[model samples]
Target: MTDIDAPEADVKRAGDEGLDARLVVDRGPFRLDVSLTAAPGDVVALLGPNGAGKTTALRALAGLVPLTDGHLRLDGASLERTAPESRPVGVVFQDYLLFPHLSALDNVAFGPRCQGASRAEARERAAAWLDRMGLADHAHAKPRRLSGGQAQRVALARALATRPRLLLLDEPLAALDARTRLEVRAQLRRHLAEFEAVAVLVTHDPLDAMVLADRLVVVEHGRVVQEGAPSDIARHPRTDYIAQLVGLNLYRGQADGHTVRLDAGPSITTTEDLSGPVFVAFPPAAVTLFRDRPTGASARNLWRCEVEGLETHGDQIRAVLTGELPLAADLTTVAAAELDLHPGAAVWATVKATQTHAYPA
Candidate 1:
């Protein structure tokens, strides 16, 4: 969808939640300058690698870090100079930071109580939130007694209990084990979907970003490299990091009729037509390797490559190759063994032009 179709109501709520920030922070040699906006009912993921300033951006929004420049507006009101507690924003940290001394119910009630709710009212609201998060049965359990997933849900309930217009979560599921991550991820998705305010989450996991956010903001070296729907970004990644994250080999080329010439020196024949600058992408599994270069092959794209690295991913072996074009090829262990492939082995990589997809770059 176009930017015009983006949720204006959500944008207003994001401001109301008190998270309008044009964060410009400098730490000696490093500088983070970014302009961000969020709306109620909008879940935006701040995604990037370590030291890419994802957390710095979040901290700036939450008032933990001071903005060196730029204005912050919440609900059209200024927040650049507002104190953290005075803002309506709620934050869930990477570690959840649940009070170890408090029961599940009490942990959730802390926010509303601090907000000046009476004991009875806070307890009632906390109970209701616990029930919503499926933690009502564990209301009396302390953080130490609860599972990772349960603690995460409690932390989320606590954040929501404050009735803030903007919600912030940092690595919400990073503390869970693989098994628990799957369970909590689905549960988190439901909660995010039901949240009516603007929500921003910071995560390095692509699955978390794709599953939780309506839009993804990819940050690298303190700049947004890409932003779009999960599927759209997955299909058309603009950077090597994004391409690797989305598990596709992306190439830019020019297409004439059925033939596409890659800038990397491989010509592919496809069924698409009418293209100027185009992008071709395929998964590593789509590439086939040959012990010897096959002659008169019907496949349109062929290249000679030297294996740069090899690693096993589950039952499959992933071969990293460098040559006329950098490519990754997936092969079975049996095939790898048959070819005696090593880091310096020579191989022929081929792809049918039909398997190459061309889209406007």
Candidate 2:
């Protein structure tokens, strides 16, 4: 289930005919270096922060950006130097990039037409694809007349009609409204799951990645920071970027008995008994903040912190604090007023030992 770099012979012997590439692209001060390998029927999602080279990696795979080094292989063939149009790759851009002048039907048929299909055959194939996307009624409608979701499906049908061996999507749902995104996302998931070839999507939304991808490849600063099943990554994040993405306060420390002495400065008591290096994680909701230290509190894990900032997170107010420990705590709107939580308010933070989960790093 892993797609990290493996020996070439081992991969070939397993009958893996999918995407095998080590892309290295340099642009001025930024350089993208990412290695990817996935077999057929695999939907891999690339997740990262802005300027993390997620788009650059996708462009390199599509041949839009030439690689400075490394190889690009798909189904036992090397496409390292192949032109974008010559490669067996299909790209669904962030904006859907549909043709303004052509109707939905003609736009879809354009891919097959470029691949040398006859006009009649292309239209026949396009019609069937639109029907499959549940957009048969809108086949003759121009891009201006169709909705955002309709345009996205048309773009997908067009990309899939060419029979691509490797499909790449750059921010597939970023352009849609919230409600439309949810609907289109479910449709896209079904299509990608049905796709028999390798499909890779780049997205910033954690929900989109978790719901759509069979596996996630988390990139940070032009490198693969973590790659695994979405559940596995969510349970045990290896970096701060991922911890924030999955909504957890993560800290690495040395563990002995039930105590974890954080490398950053403080110690956290947890229910798990472990030894050596370990990661201690707890949710923001587990933290309780007060104006002063409580004398009869049941929580053994306590820290003195100052409120650095505050923001509304969902239905609660999430306050950022820094002092004895830097962490985020979620409190009710009324409780925040009671504590007088402001930019410089001093507060005592406490968490029950059972709320913390410790695992070997």
* Best TM-score among the predictions, by candidate number: 2
lDDT per residue for candidate 1 within 50-149, as digits (tens), equals 9999999888887888988887776677877888887777899989999999999999999989999999889988888898888889999999999999
RMSD to true structure for each model, in Å: 4.6, 5.0
What pairs collide in candidate 1?
A: 10-39, 10-40, 11-39, 15-74, 15-75, 16-75, 40-197, 40-198, 41-197
User: Cα lDDT of all candidates, in order?
Assistant: 0.85, 0.91
**Candidate 1 regions off by >4 Å?**
1-21, 253-278
Model 2 lDDT tens row, 122-175: 998888889888999999999999999999999998888877888899999999
**Top model number, lDDT:** 2
The runs of at least 3 residues in candidate 2 whose Cα sits more than 4 Å from the true structure, single-residue gaps closed, are 1-16
